[model samples]
Target: MEALEAPPSLAPDNRSVIFTLSIHGREAECSVLREALEQHFWVQPGAGDARILKAFADGRKRITAVAERKLRAHSDEQIVLTSADFEVRT
Candidate 1:
């Protein structure tokens, strides 16, 4: 994200942080795992984005599994990810 912020020329299309996981293992475990990853990123200085977008899910659990996130909106979200945003894509 700092790399993005460093350049005034190409303002990133929001915070383009993408999280992808193929949870053939325990879906529940991996869902939380993904959250931890997101939090890890959020701990950065300018890691806070205005919006969070999760675009993958596990049908059985109805929880987020993967995220193609862009968090540069106005309204802010703390940690707004569910397990329904992920699916087995591999």
Candidate 2:
């Protein structure tokens, strides 16, 4: 991740400095995280995989760790968190 230059209109100060974060090479992880959130928390029952939902019942942290490990093994880029990844590991 890199910080994009702040707009000239926004002046830097001792209190705060504003800048946009430029992220790269992690599209796969972002997609996984979004899918997990939608499937696990935003969807009604019967809308997502039963195994994934069961894994999520274990805890958010466990699910997130599984997702990160899966991504690390598959690619060089950093990963975001997800619940379905826990199901896959189990």
Candidate 3:
């Protein structure tokens, strides 16, 4: 029998988005896209089970643009958004 293990954790300061990806045309292109996103988002520093893009310093649109540039297909992936704070606009 296998022993139970504890689930990984996230930092209290962390905020990010999760994306599912797919690479078409060439398999090698996938790494290129991943590298681009890492350069763009800087990925979350330190260890965790989560695969997420670090929040953009500028705002939400910048993050969306990054996703727009990287996402090649409309049907193959998912992006989950989270807000650090909840706000009501008039």
Candidate 4:
């Protein structure tokens, strides 16, 4: 990410960018959704982190959006999916 290329004077390490998703669905639906996320975004599993399903740069927005749109098709009155960004101290 461009932030990684920033000079130490800019203090890139002072902040972090994170992408997140929250979905409400059955177990089967959740599994399929996870696969869809990996297929559409530049994400890798968050190792042992349970809160983060995947992680990627802001530059991956295009594909992330496309994947979100695709997942919309599977939504119903009971299923919900959403994403948000957070800037936090590193």
| TM-score of every candidate relative to the true structure | 0.19, 0.29, 0.24, 0.24
lDDT of 2 by residue, 1-90 (tens): 432233211112211111222335343432234345455555343343443344344333444445445555766554444444535542
Q: What clash count goes with each model?
A: 16, 0, 0, 0
Worst 10 residues of 2 by lDDT: 8-17
Winning model by TM-score: 2
| Highest lDDT scorer | 2
- The per-residue C-alpha lDDT of model 3 at residue 36 equals 32
Worst 10 residues of 1 by lDDT: 2-11
lDDT per residue as tens, model 1, 35-85: 432443333334334322232221212332122131223113322343233
Model 1 residue 35 lDDT? Answer: 46
Which parts of model 4 have CA positions greater than 4 angstroms off?
1-19, 22-55, 76-90
**Candidate 4 TM-score over all chains jointly:** 0.24
- lDDT per residue for candidate 3 within 1-90, as digits (tens), equals 111122222334443333322234322111112223344445444524345432332333454434444444333444332221212246
Better of 1 and 2 by lDDT: 2
- Model 1 residue 61 distance off true place after TM-score fit, in angstroms: 22
For model 4, give the 10-residue run with minimal summed lDDT.
1-10
What residue pairs clash in candidate 2, if any at all?
none
Could you give candidate 4's per-residue lDDT for residues 1-90 as a string of tens digits? 111222111113312222333334322121123333343444454422232233333334543343345446654432222332111236
